[model samples]
Target: MKKLTSLLLAFCLTLASFAQQAFEVMTKKPTPGSTIVIEYMPRNTVLQGKKDFEATAYLLEGGLPRAVEVPLKQEGGIFRGSVKTADSTRAVFFAFAKDEIRDNNNDEGYYTALYDKKGEEVPGAHAALASAFGNFGGIWGLKRNQQKGAELNKKEFANTASQKKFATEYASYLSQSKDAADQDALRKLLTERLKNEKISEADLTQTRFFYQNALKDKAMADSVAALLKSRYPAAAQQTELVAQWNKAKTLPEREEVYQKFAAVSSPANELAKNRLEFFDQVIAGMYADSGNYEAAKKYLARIENKQARANALNSIAWKLSGEGINKQPKDAKAGLDFSKQSLALVDEEKKAMKNKPAYLTAKQYQRNLDNTHNMYADTYATLLYHKGDYEQAYAVEKAAVEGFKRKDASMNEAFTALTEKTKGAKAAQAELEKFMEEGKYTPAMKEQLQRLYIANGGTQAQWTSYISNLEEAAYNKFKAELAKQMINVPAPQFALKDLDGKEVSLASLKGKIVVVDFWATWCGPCRASFPGMQTAVNKYKNNPDVAFLFIDTWENDSNRVQKVTDFVAQNKYSFHVLYDDAKSKEGNDFVVVENFKVEGIPTKFVIDRNNNIRFKAVGFDGTADELATELTAMIDMVNAEGGDVKKGF
Candidate 1:
C-alpha cells in the first residue's frame, strides 16, 4: 500500500531515488559540436552490466533531434558504447532505461535527464528541455533537502554578485569536513543565517541535513535538533517526525517506534488520526507477515476511513488469495474469508455513498466506485480459479477479454474498409507491406492475411516466404516494388475527440508533419517512452510544420477523456491526448486505432505535409531522448524534401 504521507501517518522518503542515478553520462572535450562518442557508466552499486542497459544519443543536427542507439557491450568491469555523428550537431542528449530484466518489466533504464555544466548549483536541465520534462523522473529535479542556502530558483543566480557569491561559497563548503573547528565555524555561520528569516527555512533544514545526511555524527545531530526545537518550537515535532523516523533502518526499529507512538496516540485525537490509521496498516502487514491473520484483521477493523480500509483489505486479500508472496495456503483457501469480507465491505461502502464528499467530484466518486468493483471482480475470479471453479472463472475472464477486444473491433473495421475499397488482398497487401517494411508487423493479423494471401488458398510456407528476406538488398527491391504501387496514400482519415472534448481530425492536420502514437495508460513500455515523445513535442512546440497526436486507445473507462486527463495531471506530463472511441458508430471498435491497424501499444506513425505516410515505428526503446531524435530526423528529412514520401524500408 502507498501510505498517505500525512503530518499525522508520518512518511519519509530515504535512500534517494533509484531510477534517477541509474547511469552517469558525461561529455568529453569538444562536447556539443564535435563528433563525441556518447558513453554511459554504471555509477551506482546496484548496476553491474548483468542486465541490458542502453544509452541512446539524441543529437541535435540540422536543427532537429536525431537519435542513434550506441551499441553497448560488457567487457569485464566496463559497460560502454559509442556512435559517429556529424560535426554540425549543436547538442547531444542522453537517457538511460532498462529492458526485460529478471522477469519483470524494467523500463527505468531509458530516462534521459539534461544537465548543463553551468556555474550554478542548479538542477541539470536546459531551459526549454527542463520546462518540457516534468521533474525528469527525479533524474534532474532537486530534492527539498538538497536546497541548503535558501531554496532559490535556477534563474536567481543571474541576479549577480551576492547570489553568485553565496552559490560559490555553498559549493565550496560542500566538500568541507565537519571537524571541531570547522563545526564551530559552520555553527556560527548557520546561527547568523538563521536570524535572517529570508533563508531560515533553508538554513534550519540545511543544518539538519548537513548533520544527519552528511556528517552522520549523533552529537552534531543532537545539538542541531535541540537548536531547531528552540528556534521553531511550534513546528519542531513535525520536523523531527520525518527526519528521525526516516533514519530507522531495521524493521524491528521501525516497528518499535510505530508501536511506541501508537501507545500514546489518542484514537480520537485529530492530530494523530492520519498517523494512527496509517500505523494500523503498517502494523497489520507486519503481524500478517508473521502468520497472524487474526491480529492483522483486528488492525484492519480499526481503520477510520471506510474506502481506504476497504481498498487495503482488497489489496491484501488479492495477494494472499493468490499464489505469490502473500499466498498463505497452497490454493489460498485460507484467504477466501478475507476476500469475501473485503468484497462485502467494498460493496457496503459503495452503497453508503449518499453524498458526494466535498473533496471528490461526482465523476471522481464514480471512477473510484468502478475501480472498487473491478478490483473485487478480479480477486473474486482469481479465488474461483484457484478453487477449481473453472466455469465461473472462465466466464469472468471471458467477459473481461471481450471488453478488451477493443483491439479486434478497431483492426477489423479498418481492414474491412480497406477490403471493400481495394482489389482484394493484392491492394490490401501493398498497404500492409508498408508496416512489414518498418518492422511494425502484427503477428495476430497473420491468419487473416494468410487467407487473402493467394486468394485460392496459399500454403503457409508460401505466405511466409513472400515476406522473407530482411537484408538491405531485398528491402530495397521491396521498396522499389512498393514505389510502383500507390505513391501518396492519404493518411487513413480519422476524427477523434481530444481530452478537452474538442474534435481533432487527420484532415485538419494535412499541411503539417503529423506524428501519431497509439498508446494506453496500462501499457508499461508506452509510459516508459512518453518522456522521449514529450521531447519531440517540445522540439516542435514552436514549429508550425509539425504536429504530434497521442491517440489514447485501449481505454476501458466510460469517461475516457477524464481518465486520460487525470493521469496526465498526476504525472505532470504535457501531451496532446485524444481518445479512440472504444465502441464507435458503424459497428466499429475504434476508428483511429483500427484505421492505423495499431494492435500494439506505442506504435508511432508519421505523415508528411503531402499527406504521405513517411514513417511507422512500433514500440520504443523506453526513452524520450531516443524517440525525439528519430522523429526529428524524419521530420527534418521530410521538410527538406518538401514532403517527398519514401516507400516503407
Candidate 2:
C-alpha cells in the first residue's frame, strides 16, 4: 500500500510540472493552403512558463472529431502553427488548453474557433484559467489571484457571437484610426452589402449625411454617388440636388457643382463668358470628352499659365493621335511641336518648383510628351512612304524603336514577365481563362508595356504583335461607334456652287437620292474610280429620281481644273464636279474633318430622297462592277421605302 501511494505521488508531481511550464494558445485562424504567419509585438513575458501547455491545432471534420497534432513554435511574442490545409474547402480548426495549466478554477485559458467555406463558426473550443506568463490572463493582465480553495463559476460561451463582436470592434477601431487598409475593407463591406440587397436608401442617406455633415469629408461623396446611381438613378442625374445641399460653399466646391450641372445639360447652360474661367478646368474636361478637340485646344490655349497651355496641348495631341489624325504629315508635325512645347513647359515648371511633384495641372505632361514623340515617329515614318522614301522611313522607324528600347529597359522586362505570365498560347485561350477576370486592356496599358519592352531589348516580334492587336482593337472600337452614327443618317448639310456657279444648297437635293463623291486629282484611288463614277452617273442620267454630285479637293497640280473639265466634256461624265479650291467654303468645312470624318480619298456618301444618308463608302477599293451593283441595290432599297432613315453616324 505504501509503494502504491509513492507511485501515485510521483505521477502527481510530473503532472504538476507539466501544468506549470505549458504554453497556451488564445485563438487562431488558419487559411487553407497558406502559411499562417502571426505577427506579434517585440516584447514577450511568456518565455519561462512553469508547465508545458498542451495547446493542439486541429482540422475539424464531420462533427468535430479529434484532429492530427501539428508542430507549433513560439518566437518572441508570436506563436506559429506548422500545419497547412490542401483543397480543404470545408475544413475547420480549433485549439484547447489542458486543465492542469489552470490558475483559477474558472475556465479562462485560450480557445481558437475556425470556419468552413460558408463561414459558420466552430464549437467546443475553450481554455481554462491559467497563471503562466504566456496565457490570456497574463496578456490581458490579472486583476487578482485566486486562493487555493476558490470556488469556480459555471459559464457558457458562444464562439460566433464573440467573433462577430470582435470583428466589429476591430473594424471600428481601424476606421477611427484612419488606417489606409481600412478604406479597402470598408469599401468591400459596403459593396458586398449593397450587392446582396442588404442596404436601403435610408441607410445610404444616413451614412452620407454622417460622412458629409458629421464627418465633413468628401471621401464618402463617391460612395453616395454610387449608391444613388444604383438605387435612384433619376435622382442621381439631377445635378441641382448637389447644389441644394448648400453645404459645399467654397469656390472650388461651387466650381465642381456647376461643372456637374454643365455636363448633363445639352449645349451647356448659358454660363457667362466671365464665369467660364471659374470652371475652366471643368470646361476643358467637357470639351475633351465631347471630342471637340479644337474647342479644348482653344480654351486651354487661352490660359495664361504655360503649364496649363502645355497640358492642354498634350490633351489635344492625345485625342488627335487616337483618331489617326496625326497620320497626316502636317498634323503629325503639329503634334510633335505641341509635345516639345509641353516638355518645355514641364521643364519650366520643374525649375520653378525645384523638381517637386507640385504642378497638379500638368503633372502628366511628361508622359504625354513621351507618347507624342513616339507617335510623331510613327507618323513621320508613314509620311516618308508618301514622299517616295520607304527605305528611309523604315530606317527612321527602326532607329526610333531602338531608342525607345534603350530608355525603358527595366520597365520592359517587368512588362514582358507579366505578359509571359499572363498570356496563354492564343488570344482565345487567354481571354477565356484570364482576360474576363480583369478589364479590357487599354491603349495606355499597351503603350506603357510596349515602350518598356522596346527599351529592354525584349522580343520585337511579340511587342509589335501586341501593338498590332491593340491597334486593331482600338480601330474596331472607334469604327463601331462611328458606324452607329453613320448608318442611314442624314448627310450633313453641304453648301457649294453648281455647274452654273450658283450656290446649290444640299437642301435642294432634299427630295432625291444624292450621291456625293469626294475626290482629288492626285489620289490614285480617285483616278481609278473615275470611270466607275461616270458609269454610275450615266446609269441614273435620265431617271430624274437621283442626283450625283462630285467634289474635287486637294488640287495641287496646275491643270487639275482644266483636266477635270476636259475629261467631263469628252467622256460626258454626266455628274456635276464642284471645284473645291483652297479657301472655298467647302474646303474650310473639309478642314474641320467633322462633317464626314473622312480620312482618305475617293470617299462617297449616298443620300436618300428624304435627305437621310443611306450609305457611305471609303477609298473605292471595289471595282466598277461592284460600285454599280452597290449603287443600284441602294437605289432599289430606298425606292422601296422600307423605312425612314435614322440620323447621325
* Model 2 weakest 10-residue run by lDDT: 148-157
- Model 1, residue 82: displacement in angstroms? 60
Model 2, 116-156: lDDT tens digits are 44643322221122112112232222222232101110010
The model with the greatest lDDT is 1
Q: Which stretches of candidate 2 lie over 4 Å from their true place?
A: 1-486, 558-560, 570-572, 584-594, 643-647
The C-alpha stretches of model 1 lying farther than 4 A from their native spots are: 1-252, 264-271, 323-331, 354-359, 395-649
lDDT of 1 by residue, 1-649 (tens): 3233222211111111112333333333233334444344465432444466555555433223555656777665555666554544433445444532211012222222222355222232122122212222222111112121112222323234433345423422432433465456555555565566554544665776665544444576677677777776534654455455577755577667666666555566565677767767776766666668888889889887877677666666666655322133433565666667776776776777764453333444555675566556556655665665645654553343233332222232233223423346576566455444443333433344555676757777877776574223434543443333222456788888887789998888878889889998879989999888888888889988789899988776566567788889998877898888765322225667877756578888877786777667778652354366567766665566533443432
User: CA lDDT of 528 in candidate 2?
Assistant: 83
Instruction: Give candidate 1's root-mean-square deviation (CA, Å).
Output: 25.6
lDDT of 2 at 375: 41
Question: Relative to the unseen true structure, what is the C-alpha lDDT of residue 246 in candidate 2, on a scale of 0 to 100?
Answer: 54
